[model samples]
Target: MDLHFGDSEPTDEERAAVDALLGPPESAWEGADRSEEDLRWARGGRAARDRRELLLPGLHAINDRIGWISAGALGYLCRRLTVPPAEAYGVATFYAMFSVAPRPATVLHVCTDLACTAAGADALCAGIEARLGPGSGVGVERSPCLGLCERAPAALAIRAGDPVRTAVSAPATAQAAVLAASAPDSAPEEPPAQRAVPQAGDPSLILLRRVGVVDPASLDDYRAHGGYTALRRAFALGPAGVIREVSDSGLVGRGGAAFPTGRKWQATASQPDRPHHLVCNADESEPGTFKDRVIMEGDPYALVEAMTIAGYAIGAHRGLIYLRGEYPRALQRLEHAIAQARARGLLGDDVLGQGYAFDIEIRRGAGAYICGEETALFNSIEGYRGEPRSKPPFPVEKGLFGRPTVENNVETLVNVLPILTQGAEAYAAIGTEHSTGPKLFCVSGSVARPGVYEVPFGVTLGELLALAGVRPGLRAVLLGGAAGGFVRPDETDIPLTFEGTRRAGTTLGSGVVMAFDGTVPLPRLLLRIAEFFRDESCGQCVPCRVGTVRQQEALQRIVERTGAAAAADIALLREVGRALRDASICGLGQTAWNAVESAVDRLGAYE
Candidate 1:
């Protein structure tokens, strides 16, 4: 194993995280033969691809251990996974989260996008910099919205071997927190997060009923409060029966693309495959959305139980939860819940003594927004660049290591729990005929009590806003996320359902309702949205890569001028936006200009 990359060597911590993903690195003590043990560990083309699939995870492990990926570490990982050094390097440098050059041990990522900006993220970042001073040995930088609008002005603390957590976090403790991170043997731990328990004014309160009411880490507590009741019912009905029940429920994906979940499960099951993969799209990176985080953190078992049911229904032996890198709390809660389930015979070979083997592995995304797309997600898991693949041989036909995979968002999977427990017909009767089941609305920004509120599909945006304690003097509402459209205050009565949102020229995408009063400047807000799309394009396609940059530039000019120049820039913006929407490969580029275009044309941001 004569390996040559760079002069640098991975630290012990880096080596350990890499080894955890793809066994120990091969040692070549001067012209050593291909070791028998290494050969056996990585055997067959299938096994080789499997080993290669560990590339991203391996890289993540390396970065997780060390602050950045050094050339020596990347080369070691490439050799271990049998991947090309060039390809591995390309991957290492592709994501915003990964850094190639030497940097400080602690990288404090302060959120300065939309919701956070409104909540004083700019002031917080300046305060942190002021406290750290020059050559503080700590690195501080601004990050996009961390899907943490619920706790606005959030900052993530990334230290070697420590879970990424909100740093010097609270709006009040911003200055003190930064000083602590820089001080000697100091860095007072962030105060425990005071999780909000907003009681939905709507009496139904289904999706959020268990959120603040249950011990997320306790399996017995979940079971006592009707947890595995869904799984038990799933067992009673069998795979076909369970699929049928889902079909009857009219349940659709909550991560935008309201495709029916039951049809996808059926398609994956119908494929001639012995093992299928179930992926819970826990990568909730859509700006202004943190509902998935709440579900995973407060009601972790619901997700665990839901995933098992999905695996059983789709004939999958394994499940993968692609969690976001910023969600350390959710990750911890879900991991503990998984462990508890495995210990209780709820997840493992012969789950609940029903002879159905299903297990979950949590894979963290290294800050790639495009990986939220199904095909891109698969590619990321398979050790390739996190770029979206062409459709036709859709995910159901071939996904996840080139096998049939049924992918569902966190909210979509959790919906399965209630569907099975209460029966499909009963569940379908709750919401509108087209959009069924309860929904989690991540209400944040310019509101009195920003939090997650559950409502039935037909509930209006106005109702949701009022429930979230929106203050007077409402200006505009950015529905969905950065990728979702905008609606004026008058349209607050628009029903927050899939079809209703469509009729109103918007989407109930992941149920993100950001209320903006007249105070927050829309031009800068729209510019931030444009900048996010430009940075997260992945550069795999020409349209998105170039169009996003053009869009941002156009918004900049428009923001700079309000007369004829702004008018001309607005037209140019629309042209570039149309190109991105029509020519881009993935949903990211397609919807890149959604918020800005809606803000400009409908809400009159710049003009």
Candidate 2:
């Protein structure tokens, strides 16, 4: 636990993990054995400081190799990056995935979030724990949503070794989960990405048209299906023209904020600041939201192509994807797609031989939902705790190492492809006058067909649910995930758009549409949501830190009470909720109470 040098030396395996990420340290000062030259000069320290951002990746390297980060390994990594030991420890402990203490080499993450809970995750967890009890040489950790809501009760197994191996078991049973945890390399292969897309072959699809039709690994297949056509058009249009086309399309962000994508791009491009940056927020951590994961796994090239176009439009030559660490399949697919693009000159300097330079790098988020926020994502990538910075100096003005940065989610970036290829006028006409282009909705929980469904923005909620075959006796629908609100089943006629949802006093937050039938317990669901907020709060500010905990406590107190009996606690909830929404710094706190409040008022859970 000591944060001082020489307190504990890294073991051979730990040292190898750090060295593999940063390459061998050049001098004795940089974690090498003490030597005469280390006393004369601290030359390597300056070089190490320049690469401080690699600190997170370095921690991943060690954790992936050993399954847990040891104090010795963390100290060694800090020395290599010239980071203070305490600061490095803070970053290491900030994420849920990383473990600083010793544990089993293999760990199984069982999803217990909303969708999974509805599908009997409670029983699955109990069974798995009984099977993998102490001394089983495998660890069982209950996790939040694994972004596999379609196939609920999902389990992800990670076995650390020379090459860390991962296996996924969705709709998981105790036996299968234990098998995956015990022998990850021998676990069954996951279902293809297309399986998550119920409307795979539909020609009406725009954002997901090529998802299942083309081979994700083959660049030729992607191009034949209209892959880099957008980039080609972007090159012809030039940066300004590309921005103009996007602006004309009326495209807004798909990530909850619903900001105009064109304005963000224009602001970043117009910034007098040198070397603007583009960031793709691929950390799809919003519970019950997996549309972005489907796109990355099924059609990764589209995201790569879109990022290139976005970077070009924003006067940026470099783009970064802050992908969540748990998406092993999506991660593998994207890494392969990027390598193929680089090999074919679709990426790197002189992209498409258009004399324009652009490239991308992926940074894995350990396990932090707050990192989905633009500013927090930048901090996580910059080797700090993922915490949101105040606005005013927004991302477009000062972001990503204090430079003009344009940040968009995967779904938002991919929308640009249709805008450029089909022309802004055509794309704008598909949806309502305000909410343009197609939207992907993640439908799960008590639905016959649970998957990512692509529909035009203004489709009624009832229509969307009908496509998914909503179960009989539906009670309520959760539009958006834990952060969104609840609506009675009778209110399904609400239009599914940013403006429409706003008018209805709800939000189309990240296009999450979870259903619940009469058999499901609304009280437990609300309590679970409160627990999620409490667990995920970054604790940087007092309103969120205390408010989330207080909210969960209040909900827990009222879970068994009803009507007037619950009135006192319900009143307490509203006061805490208002404080969180009003005084919190970031969206996480601002929206923490949204679902709970809606459940109380709309569904009347207490009464």
Candidate 3:
């Protein structure tokens, strides 16, 4: 049975809602040199040629600027670009990021790419939704691509604010100064409630804010407001002191396993090796999480500096950023930032004249979620299909072409520069015991304000839901992604700390929170998840490949025919869930049963 469903045609009300979200398509705020002809070309026309070339680019540009492209706006774009409205709609729908429906206050994008889905993106979406309420102020969106594919299942948070206007100028076009008679020197102020904390006020806060914390142009302002001070401080302290400070800070890995970073560094540093390596795991494939993308786009230097510090700490002379090929912009920015750092002598040999040599190179992955796993990532770096390798001699002992290596997620490395600069105890003071510092939770789906939120570990799910602005009468919560467990609405009261989630029979796998209201059918949701697993499974293991297929067929049977034997099917589902959990080879096959288990626990009667 085909599980892919077509979207319902937008209703009149939906069209109006979409229009309201996207302001007037033609604005005086646009560049003066831009002509009506340019607008016409951008809007698209009926001609096939005009529709493909003229209209699609314009729609993409509009979506990039507005965070969402509306149907009404598509009509306007068709007129401007000389393309048909239907063609524009087709292009918009082709990309998962564009939304025809009215946007909520914030957009929480969960990466549903293969890697993230396998990592537990589904559970994260479900958990956040259950806590917040479905389709609340936050609109949780699933993105097919965010370019951070190596960082599989990444997510991003875009909040609704005043439109950001930019001038479009061609290379040959003369610069025209068209000043409005009453144009304010400063941009119009956002309402007090909408304005988030200033991204530039504190250095540590700036790191958190850099995760889509603010605008790109504002990055120079961040640099001016003491962005690289931490790096400078690290240079002063030398590598050993930097390692000591990070160790004291108690910062652990933001990747699935919460291992202490400083200890990992110490291991590499103590190793008497010629070319020890530091690698930034930009393969954030865990679903319902996109915090790394924000950091990469908003503040590339923070990661650069953090990696530099790691290079110093581990006595490594070179570093490699295993960035996903999907994140083209991020790769570009990182490449630019690396050049800038090298020019400033912050990278390269004798950085800042301290005689400490370190440099970084970017290695792009060809869209694999399992590559997020260190061993698999290493294989990909060596030109192989991304797949996990058996552990014993972990990445630290034997990684990256058999060299002693330290691999860490972008967020974990981003925290390093700050912790090294600020004392360790200061960093440890933010979150609960064991899990120190603020965690960036990519909360999406059915919430009032779905976005990337930084909360100290140990905050209750209820509190996070409140922050997310979930609506009333939440039905269920799917913690983690497909790999996570499910909790009913009553469990929202549980604390969201790692320990707390563990106590509730769920691991805080990748910190993705998704909530859902009663509008979503639980059985249908499980079936969708089952189908995804069956399609994406690498088929290396019997439990994952066959089990997922079996589960999908069984669920289909139940959904198709409801009878007295439905209970028997549900029991069979429970048994399959347990088997997959126990017998699977890798995380993909292993945690594939999370959604099924959760579904059976909460809404088994529907099966």
| Highest-TM-score candidate | 2
Candidate 3: tens digits of C-alpha lDDT, residues 421-442: 5668888898888788888776
Model 1 lDDT per residue over 1-607, tens place: 4435766665666666677776653443211246767545544434444578778777777777777888877866765666777788877787778898988877788888889988877788888888788897788878887877877877777775544333435343466557545542354543333344477333456766776567777888888888889999999999999999999999999999999989999999999965789998988888988888878888899999999999999889999999998887788898899999999999999899988888999988888888899999998887888999998789898888878999999989989988888889999998899999888888899888888877788988888888778899999999988999889988888998888988988888877889888889888888899999989898989999999999999888877878988888888888898999899998999999889878876887765
User: Model 1, 202: alpha-carbon shift in Å?
Assistant: 9.0
Reference-based TM-score of each model: 0.93, 0.98, 0.67
State which candidate, 1 or 3, has the greater lDDT: 1
lDDT of 3: 0.64
For each of the candidates, the C-alpha root-mean-square deviation to the true structure, in angstroms, is: 3.1, 1.3, 14.7
Please write out the lDDT profile of model 2 over residues 477-569, one tens digit for every residue: 998899999999889999999989999989999999999998888899999999999999999999999999999998988986666758988
Worst 10 residues of 1 by lDDT: 24-33
Residue 371 displacement (Å), model 3: 1.5
Ranking by TM-score: 2, 1, 3
State each model's CA lDDT, in order.
Answer: 0.82, 0.92, 0.64
Count residue pairs with overlapping backbones in model 1. Answer: 1
Q: State residue 40's C-alpha deviation in candidate 3, in Å.
A: 63
Candidate 1 at residue 481, lDDT?
87
